[model samples]
Target: KTTNMPERPFDSENARKKQHAEQSNNELDENSPTNNNEQSGDEEDDDENQIKGNEEEDYQEDDDEETPDFTDDEYGSEFTDDYLCPELMAERPQEHESLNNVIIVDNLPKVDPAKLEKLKEVISKVYNKFGVCRNVYYPLDKDGKTKGYGFFEFQNEQMALEAVKQTDGYRLDKNHTFSVTLMSEFERLTQVPSEATDIGNLLSWLTEPDAVDQFAVQSDDPKKTMIYSNALSQPILLEERSKWTETDFVWSPKGTYLASFHEKGIALWGGKEFRQVQRFAHTGGVQHIDFSPCERYLVTTSARPGNSEAFIIWDVITGQKKRSFPVEQGSPYFK
Candidate 1:
């Protein structure tokens, strides 16, 4: 009856335990005169015999203690307590680990010793038609039979999806149907619950969609102007970069450019590189600056004790000064 159920990683360990129990009972029955065969002397069978012995030892139950019950109160809710493993209704996944680019294939027809070897050889070539396979795994029971399932890890996610889409319904043989899904699909607890962000998951935070836009926090104590993402999506550091004497940082009206003031001039910057885009040279930095509402004009002004004060307007994109007005140093008429 269990043969009809597809083999899934979620229920694998439980199925093994149930099968081993049944096998053990069969072994006890065989101990009667009907199973008095001599131990094999063939060296090739040694590994298989050893594996079987190990499995028997692992399943042996101690007479004194009771096995624990599967319940949400004890284990936490993740997989469905019902249909996830149809045949093994009470079974549960041992762990939930996502093998990102890997996929599981199952429901191959059971074959004899000779046919099983042929199936393993052909199945690999069949999967490889879609993409490069990084690794393959097929475990055999003690009897050396193909357990009707295999796992193929591809070089990338695209290859895995191609394999699944291309072969999902095709039959491996007349007796069984093929089943395929990402290894993540079997994981009952794919997400790790966390109370706060820490080193373990910090790298993932940097890749969030909001991490690209930037802002700045300027201060003299740090000696450096700190440029950071306006979204606070990543760590921003100003460090020791105190070079600008200008009191304010001006962003162009459209925000396509950020202007920094220094004793020499006003410099415009933009892009992912955050490099200086253009410089408007001034002997003494501007006292105030503003971008026209349409962002086509950049206006700069200077206030000084000398007889000459200056107000200039320039083309914002070309950095070409279009006009300049000289004002008397103490011009109360301008205020």
Candidate 2:
């Protein structure tokens, strides 16, 4: 017991100091600077995370404010009501000229060579009478024959109207009658001379040649006429005749051909040479004729009293009938 107790001998100051040291160590552990630093760092990290979350929320709000909605009524209302009707929206020209610059002559009978020259002379006289010197175009048919009607353009409306008034119903050839009127407005725009002031003058200039020849008037048979020319210093006379028996003829697009109808057939002639290049026979008289714009085909109407009306389309090249249709009484001009 003495040996075991002898090792436990400790000084009072040493034991007390050891106990104080232990207490000091416990106090230091409770309030260490390293722990305080770790706590402060955690608080700083939380603050930084909260600030970042607020910034993210602000950015999302900004993005939502920028989008546009198309379903609103203000977007497309004005564009739909303006351009729908084209005709009403069309703008008319500010300056408009009179329609009297264009001249249309109707109701002319087929003329032979002698009467053709006379008709040319009469047209010249008419132009001279009006004191205009514009060009006149007399388009002929495929047979070198004049379509009964032609157009004359003047330099101005006054001149054109003068020609119309002077020449309408004015006789040039014995059996031919003429009707003159202002051309339609559309025709005036397309065919009248751009700078012409007098169409009658222009026509007069076209027919004046260096020489004149004379030949006998062919016949009064109302079907045959003779024409003579001596421009080449030699007298030449040719008999002019038309196979058509009906009135109201039209010229081809180029004014180089004539289309006409007759009691028995339809005929087309080239203007330069009086040769019949096309002919279509019909059981009845051919009353009307019209050519397509492209000149690929022609339509003819055959109507006789007490008989059913019929229409035929013929190939321009071969003069062969391509189609036929029957028409009722008082039907339209074209079926």
Each candidate's TM vs. the true structure?
Answer: 0.33, 0.29
Residue-level lDDT of model 2, residues 65-143, one tens digit each, is: 9565688888655664335655654553222232456676776666665577766776666666665636566767776
Model 1 clash pairs are: 214-229, 215-228, 223-241, 223-242, 224-241, 224-242, 226-238
Q: State, as a TM-score between 0 and 1, how close model 2 is to the true structure.
A: 0.29
TM-score of 1: 0.33
Model 2 gets an lDDT of 0.65
What stretches of model 1 exceed 4 Å from their correct place? 1-208, 211-213, 232-246, 307-309, 329-335
RMSD of each: 34.2, 22.9
